[model samples]
Target: MEGILNAVVLFSNFVLIPGMAYGSQLALGALGVTLIYSILRFANFAHGDLMAFGTMFVILITWWLQSIGVGIDPLPTALLALPFGMAAAIAISLLSDRFVYRFYRRNKSPAVIFVIVSIGVMFLMNGLVRVIIGPNDQEFGDGARFLIKVREFKEATGLNEGLALKLSQGLTIAVTFVVVIALFWFLQKSRTGKAMRAYSDNEDLALLSGVNPDKVVIVAWVIAGSLATIAGTLYGLDKSFKPFTYFQLLLPIFAAAIVGGIGHPVGAVVGGYVVAFSEVTVTYAYKKFLIYLVPESWEPESLVQLLSTEYKFAVSFVILVVVLLVRPTGIFKGKVL
Candidate 1:
């Protein structure tokens, strides 16, 4: 029984908790991607860089605040700087839409053209972020490091295994809950949200029915920008902020979005947890976990990991390929990609 308890605790510490935090981050990112695809009718390849850009601003603001001796004890100082970072991100998103996307939208360019343009934008944003913050990892997290300490847990439970929960993980889950609720409310009840939905469903019909295309597009960008910033900031708090890391995150983010159903918001959230857990579970070395459950004679001699941690991203790629091949519309029947 004690071994079983220890096994559960160990699994929770290494896999469950981290998976949830990572899922929340991925969900937010996937939401942004789905929003743009639903409304704008194109996948924004630059979404990852958008996240990096917003996080870069948040990091700068956090540093400035720390230098001035301002902070919210027990809470990340990044929270205080979030609004400013969001605003900056939103501004850039709008500017990009106006200068780059709007022209193509006006000309009624094909989705392929928009996709190519987004790739260009991706490179541009990536370059800009690297120039501003450098390609090196940036450590900006500051606050209470843990909500539950391993030593404390062991002492309290008198168990061989301990569970530790980080403050950033808790914050990520909490903030994601709030954001998702607010988004659902807005989409379900607000006039603007309805218009956006109508446009997404049928642009020609929506325009004929007096839905302003420009307004819908603007709102989509605003929401996407906000989500990107929040997700990036939360992820940075949980891990370190590296510009290239976010770029690499593009694979998992897109996988989550597609797996959940590209145009479906609910699907994005669900897909996030699915991808996160899959990656964490598959990469985790399960030798100790099995040892806790099996007889001494059956104890494994080698790590029971399906794949190394370094190949975790490949899990997302495989899932993405499988989903695309089996059901292009995804689990929620969002849109045929």
Candidate 2:
């Protein structure tokens, strides 16, 4: 009974809640990538920067709002400013597509060329964000900090182990769920969204059927902008917002997009959770918790963390490698393009 109880607690603490929250974040981020990939037809390396920029906008707005004593009661007022952040991102994306990408599209440039172009766009966006934000960590998310505390959990459950769930995490999950559902509904049911999917499925057929590639691409960018803002802001709320953090996130975002199957919206969500769970599980130290379950004599003479937090990035790459070796198309038949 003791062993069973310990195992159940360990599983819950190390896997269940953390995985869901982290997965939600990944899914949100991956959705933006998948949308851009489907319409833009390239692996956008700069998406991470877009995420950074969006969160920065939210952080700035939050700080400004807080300074004026205007805060959302019960919930973080940053939620109120998220739309503005999203709008800023959308406007920027539209401008970028027009000035930086429209010519290439008109000239019928190769996908590889577009990929290289994205690198340039990424550099430009990165520089622009750093310049505007001054390359410093910004903290703006505030209000209703924690839904539950570890002490409360212990008192409520009468368990040796307890976990705290931040209000930010809860809000992040709820908002992400709503956004993802809305996105899927748009893609699967809305007329324009279906048209976009048709284009993604077969560009020639879509064009033959009178699909306006430009319009569809613009819509994709709009949706991607919204997603990026939400992902970046929520992540900043849950973790911390650092301009450079987005640069590091690009590889994992790529891994998530590929893992879930590129160009597939559903795949992106799955891949996000996969990446999140892998990172959390591998890096989370289990030694302290395990000692409670195992007898002293049986406890191994070493820490049980699969990998240290410093190697968290490696976890994503390793998963990607295995996925490619076993199933290049991803577990869900993501985009071959």
**TM-scores of the models, in the given order?**
0.99, 0.96
Candidate 1 segments whose C-alpha is farther than 4 A from its true place: none
What does candidate 2 score on TM? 0.96
> How many pairs collide in each candidate, listed in order?
0, 1
Query: RMSD of model 1, in Å?
Result: 0.7
Segments in model 2 whose C-alpha atoms lie over 4 Å from true places: none
Worst 10 residues of 2 by lDDT: 1-10
Error of 1 at 111 (Å): 0.6
Candidate whose TM-score is highest: 1
Q: For this target, which candidate reaches the highest lDDT against the unseen true structure?
A: 1
